[model samples]
Target chain A: MLASIVNPLILGISIGSILLISALGLAVIYGAAGVINMAHGEFIMLGAYSTYTLQSTMGMPFLLCIPCAFFIVGIIGFVIERNLICYLYNRPLDTLLATWGVSLVLMQSSRLIFGSDVKYIAMPEFLSTNLELGILNFSTFRLFLIAVALILLFITWFIFYRTRLGIKIRAVTQNKEMAASFGINAAQVYSITFAFGAGLAGAAGAMFGALSIVLPTMGMHYVVEAFLMVVTGGGSILGTVFASTLAGEIQSIFAFIFNDTMARGLLFILIVVLLRFRPQGLLSTGSGRR
Target chain B: MSFTRRKFLNTAALSSLALAAPNLWLPGAQAATSLKADSPIKVGLLFSLTGSLAVPEEDSTLVMQYAIDEINAAGGVKGMPIEPVIVDAKSDFKVYSAKTKEMILRDKVISIFGCYTSASRKAILPTVMQQDNLLFYPTCYEGAECTQNCIGTGPLANQHSFDLIPFMVDNFGPKVFFVGSNYVWPKESNKNAKVWLERSGGELLGEEYIPLGSSEFGPVIEKIRAAKPDFIFSTVVGASDIAFHRQFKQAGLKVDKMPIASLTTGEIETAAMGAEYGAGHFLSAPYFQTIETPTNEKFVDGFLSSPYGKNGYTHYNMEETYLSAYVFKNALEKAIDMHGVTDVTPRKIRDAAAGVKVEADVSPEGLVWIDGDNFNTWLKPKIGQCQADGSFKVIKEAADHVAPDPFSIYPDSGKCTADGLLGLDGKLKVDLI
Candidate 1:
């Protein structure tokens, strides 16, 4: 009985961390910039490809590739913001379409360059093993992911709450015109915020690429869940975290009772039901900012 | 004027005469060397160059070209140079159907070689049959299908599972778990394995199917940990195979203790998943890159030297695709001899494919022959254990070519002969399940 209970919970937490990591980037972008960011998954895919290039071609250590992926994708995100996204700021629908087009370009470009074969990202020797703690037996890499997710969350929290840029970002997210009047340079804040969020996605991709296979279309798999956590969480970081954990546990419990397919189907149904009841989502922002 | 009974009989008589003694009856046999020095026999190379199926299908496409080039270098098939009319199906089933029509009706290629998934093959089946064209499919599939329009050169369901299941049961315990991608191929392959498992008195602990391209194996892994099955019979294909192996490794399931014996994990997948993750896991295929035969060695060396050899590993899919071109070549030669060089059509080539046989020298897999009765090729099954060097080490192999039994699960199995489904009508019949 204890094994049964602990196993699902541990599995739930493990999957929850994966969900949270993947959702963090989308949440950050939607929360701050109010951009739906259709290319967020591609940004994550680019991060994985960046990590793959670094590790495979450059022979960089896997631990170093995560931050490198962040900066690499972050730089790319900065360029995209300056060139395209900056043009369609108040035009949310246009930004959505343009970012989606950007995603298609990125996907095709990666296919051409990498040749669409699945590539592997090697992890350190220690992380490949498992951790057995009585009834709580799990992958060490999963535990590492949990730790990484927490560290990332804490850092993002620190950045958003404890920094001067955080104030500028929050101010801009609340009122772009007012922040521009206050000399905050709301456009610059949006660029930085978008880059940061993309960097977070890149970081997630580094871990994810190591976690699974790397392919040109691997982003499509994670993007759905990322969007789910973002939308259901009302586009806030804390809300995403809570929603992922809750969703993971619920999925785990359902999977434990039934099977993975049924669990996934039931989870989608439940999410639909949840959304129908609460149109503003599980946790709505108190701020009256669109 | 129409496809009259007298016209059909005459065509059939001519084809049978050609099959019996092509060298004796062909008046063009003497003039063949002078007939087609400039004119080339066009064959369609239909494969997905983009989308989800592109990765594996890329090698298949390359190997098809390599085989065609090799055939052309060897004095061409019946003194006519073969030209490939390549087209990307874009990994869509509808595109496969459209391309089949376009290749048959528009380009008028004699024969086509392509398709990795059974769905794509099924999509093109009606078009091929309706247009009386031939499609040479090269992917090992869950075989409950037999058709004259398509010649399957890959291993059938029985060819893969018959030997592997018994081997697993004898080596490991009797408790087996079935995991596959939720699709027709996996489900059918698993169903085939279940039949074999029952024959060996093995118990199935659990059977589960995950959606295609899924990465989260945690819930499934948890269930596996709880069940403690002796071995896992995985049919998970594509990129998902990489995650399944990595997470299985991370979940502390030692291959020595409880191995993942799979049908889908090949050289490309194993290399991409890493040797560390796949080491000690088992796979069953008709061909592996590590096979120590002169034919396979040459094939591997030639593929690695090719422009499309960047991935640097060859598996059964490529080997089969390569051999399939040779199969088509041999069949087309007979067809050309039967209907003369200029008069050869897809219908004539499809007729000749039934009697075509390729020897060991040209084929990487030894001595593959298209069954004149069923239009499926005979294949040798091999069980390989994944090594730490990202290659599979052949553990066991069939001493002889295993004849394909596509409908082995049925009591009236193998009844669908060359005359087509149930040996009654020559119409296309696919997917028993």
Candidate 2:
């Protein structure tokens, strides 16, 4: 009985780590800029495709591809912000529609170029094996994923909390007019912030691409969970972490008691009920937007 | 009646029109007067050219075209070239229904040859039945319904599980776990597998269904680890297949020790998941590209020469799809020969298909014949282990064609006949009971 309880908790953390990695980019973008970026999933897809191209054409190692994917996707994100997103600032609905359209375009573009075959990312031989600690057993690659997620989270926290650019981004996020009056280039900060968020997603993609098959529509699977985590966490980075882990644990426990399908259905119902009771979300601020 | 120059030309045209008018209405016309002697016989190539299911379905479409081209090059079928009216279903069931309608009603295609997933096949079922058109479906599926309008060219439940389970029990231990995507096909497949397991005297460790296209398998993995099944009978389809294999490999599971005996995984998926992930796993299918038969070699060579066969790997689905076109062609030719060219119709061709037998040299898989009883093809079930090159290494094959039994799960359920399903008590039933 104790084994059952402990096992689900550990498995839940593993699941939560995956959810957090995928949702980190969405959380950063939404939390910092208050922009409901629907194209975030496609950005991760692009990161996967970028890694594929670099690995196949340039013969880069898998470890090298992760950073390459980050920079490549970050550049694309910067370009998208400067050209498209900069004009839709403060218009949440318009941003939402535009990003959705962008996502569709990106998906179609990849399909046309890559054709619809599933692509694979080769991982290191050691990472492909399993790791076991007594009753706790799982994939070594999954443990690596958890480690990567934590490192990315730590870097994100450091950038936002310990850096000068973090203050500018937060200041602009809190009050765009006041930040602009204070000589902060709010547009530049938003651009950098969006790029950084996209870069984080790219890093996540490199890991995810190794975990599963890489395809044009792979983003569809992750984007929903990412959106759910961000919404449940109230668009806060730390809150997303806590909410994702909690949700994962609950889901894992439910699955242990029931089955996968039932657990997922119950999880969705619980999320609905939780949102109904706490409309502002788990740890969101109870203040109106400036 | 002034016989001027203009009047003479008008009189001549009227006389020719009157002479040709009877040929249009006469059923006994010696030739196809409705079409020019060189006009092609139009058929619809309906498949998802885009969207989630496009990967394998698109390959099916390409193989269909290649088959049509081959038949057209060899003096065409019954001296009439085959013209394909291609349409993209976009992996949507609604789109499948609409496209089937457009093909039958507007394009006037003789038949449609497509559909990989059972959902799309069911979606277009009503359209084909209502229009009284023929559809050649070439994908393995959970068998229950037997429709004359739609001919199944792939293996059914009996051909796959009946042959696969016994082999697995003999080779591996009898403790099997069932895992599949949450859908009708998977559920029905598992249901059939359960019956097979019982008959084989195997023990069921666990059964789980993961949502389609879902990548998360952490909890499911934990369950499987705990159960310690000797082997897994997997019906997971699409992208999820890749995820399952990759995760299973990463979880330190030994494929040689506990192989995934799959109905869905093929060369395409194995290639996508990488050879390392799929290596040593078992797949049950009717055909594998690595088959060393001279006929398969020629077929593989022909596919490689085609534009879409750049991947250089073909599997059961593509082989079945390739042969379905030939099945249709052979049936049409037989119909034309029997009833004359002008009297050939979809119904006549569908009826003639019951008698059509494709020789082993013609079909890469082997001799194939449509079972007049259930409208499903007789196929040889084969088991192949995944190799390091992402291709199957054939290990076992049935000696001959296995009769398709769509209602194999229910022993006394009735057999499909011309009149309908006929039960054991000499009573006629409308459908499977």
Candidate 3:
């Protein structure tokens, strides 16, 4: 029995790792700019597509393709911020609506180009093969994803607390108007921060693309769940990570005991209960409610 | 609107260039009005590529394109050429309605080949029936959507599910429990299983349904364990299946200890469940790449050779849609050949379909047969268990072959095809098989 739970736990951990990676970027965007950029998923799509185009089409190796996919999508995110999300900073929900329209356009464009069918990214031998140990098995590519995600998570923390760019970004997030009065480049930081968040989503998508098919609207289920994950994880990097792990573990156990439907139902109920108790999150350091 | 032949030629040349610019626009499209006038054949390749249903839908459309390639290469119906029109339904019923209307009203397509979901099929039938156009629905369906206007390329659950019961009972002597998503497909599938069990004198320990897309299946697993049923009959779909298979694997139940006979479990869903998550699960479907047939052998080869399926997929619909295109081609040719007419219409194709019979190389069984509703019969299902290496083993035939019935298993119960279902109790008055 103990042996059996090992696999689901690991699967949960993989799901949690990506959720945390993707959600933290959104958390940072919110923490800095109160705007929820709904097109964040499209950036992820862009990243996956970029990876697929490079690795599958241009025949780039998986190891080299990751950074390329991320940066390309991040640059696109930056362009999107400059052209679209920059001026809408003051109106949060309006930003949401605008991003939603942008998301539709992006989705439509991808469909027009790729022809509305799901596309498999086709991982190479190194990323696709698996390692097994007494039923607690892991895919080689998935392990690579975890390693990358963890490294990024640590680097993000280090930047936030120990680096100059991190300090400036934080200052803008803490009090954007005050930071502006102090002559910080708040708008540039805003653009950079939004692009950075999108970069994270793109990275996650590129990693996930190896695991699943890349459909244009594939992000719908994960996007909402990720927003919830960010909130439950306390809306900070550490908070989001903590919440995602917590949610992941709970979901695994419930799914282990109940089934997929009941597990999701129970998890939803558990989240509601947690909200009633903490209102902000279990590890929350912020004022907002997710 | 008067035009000289020179002007018409210039206008046509420009339009052809525009259509030719995007090669992917119509994969198997033929542009030739070089023949006689007053007769046309329009073919619709309908699929969901942009929206929610694009995942499985991509394979359907791509494989259909391959079939159209084979048909057009063989010289289209009466050699007048095949015009392949694209319809991206995008997973919306309203969009499906509007596009289908456009296909019938505007394009005047003689036949349509697309749609995966039961709801999408149901939504399009009224429009297709009203316009009296033929539709070839190429997806394994919930089994109740068979109508005069539609010829299903997909298996109804009964043919696969009922056949498996007898085979599993013979091989494993296992007591059975039913588990599936709480939806129409599973509900109808369970109904079919119940009838078969009743006929076979088999024991039915329990039946249950979980909400679709739910990730927690622990309590149900516990109940199955407690009941100590020897096996499970699962009708779960897509992601829910991955979650279920993972949980069951975690519970220390080996495939041999408690075998699973499943309806909706296929290569597409199994592979997506990932090799580790869904390893060693059994499925019953019309065609398996591993099914011993020269045709199937070539099909698997052709699909893998293509860049789209370079990574390898257990796409059930891809095989079905490929065969369906062949089915469409044969039916159209038979109709035209018999009548000696160049002007092909939907009515002729539908009439020709009734008399047309074609054999499939891809079918698990040797031949493909079509009943009154044009649902093909030759491709009976076989059991295939997923292997650790992410492939499947053909567990041999449940019978020499299983038959498909589009309406009620008891066909007479649906002289009243009221709402695509009979009343409660599900007691069909006829045996369609």
Ranking by TM-score: 2, 1, 3
RMSD for each of the candidates:
8.4, 6.3, 8.3
> Which runs in model 2 stand beyond 4 Å of their true positions?
A1-4, B1-38, B423-433
State how far residue A84 of model 3 sits from its true place (Å).
4.0
Q: lDDT of model 1 at residue B245?
A: 94
**Tens digit of per-residue lDDT, candidate 3, span A109-191:** 88777655445555555554456676455556546656887987876788788988888988887777788899999999988
Q: After best superposition, candidate 1 residue B176: deviation in angstroms?
A: 0.3
Question: How are the candidates ranked when ordered by DockQ, highest leading?
Answer: 1, 2, 3
The model with the greater lDDT, 1 or 3, is 1
Question: How large an RMSD does model 3 have?
Answer: 8.3
lDDT of 1: 0.86
Candidate 1 wrongly placed segments (more than 4 Å): B1-38, B412-414, B423-433
Candidate 3, fnat value? 0.13
List the lowest-lDDT window of 10 residues for candidate 3 chain A.
A116-125
Per-residue lDDT of B121-173 in model 3, one digit per residue for the tens?
78877777766677888777756553556776667766767677877777766
- For each candidate, what's the DockQ? 0.65, 0.65, 0.17
Candidate 1 chain B weakest ten by summed lDDT: B28-37
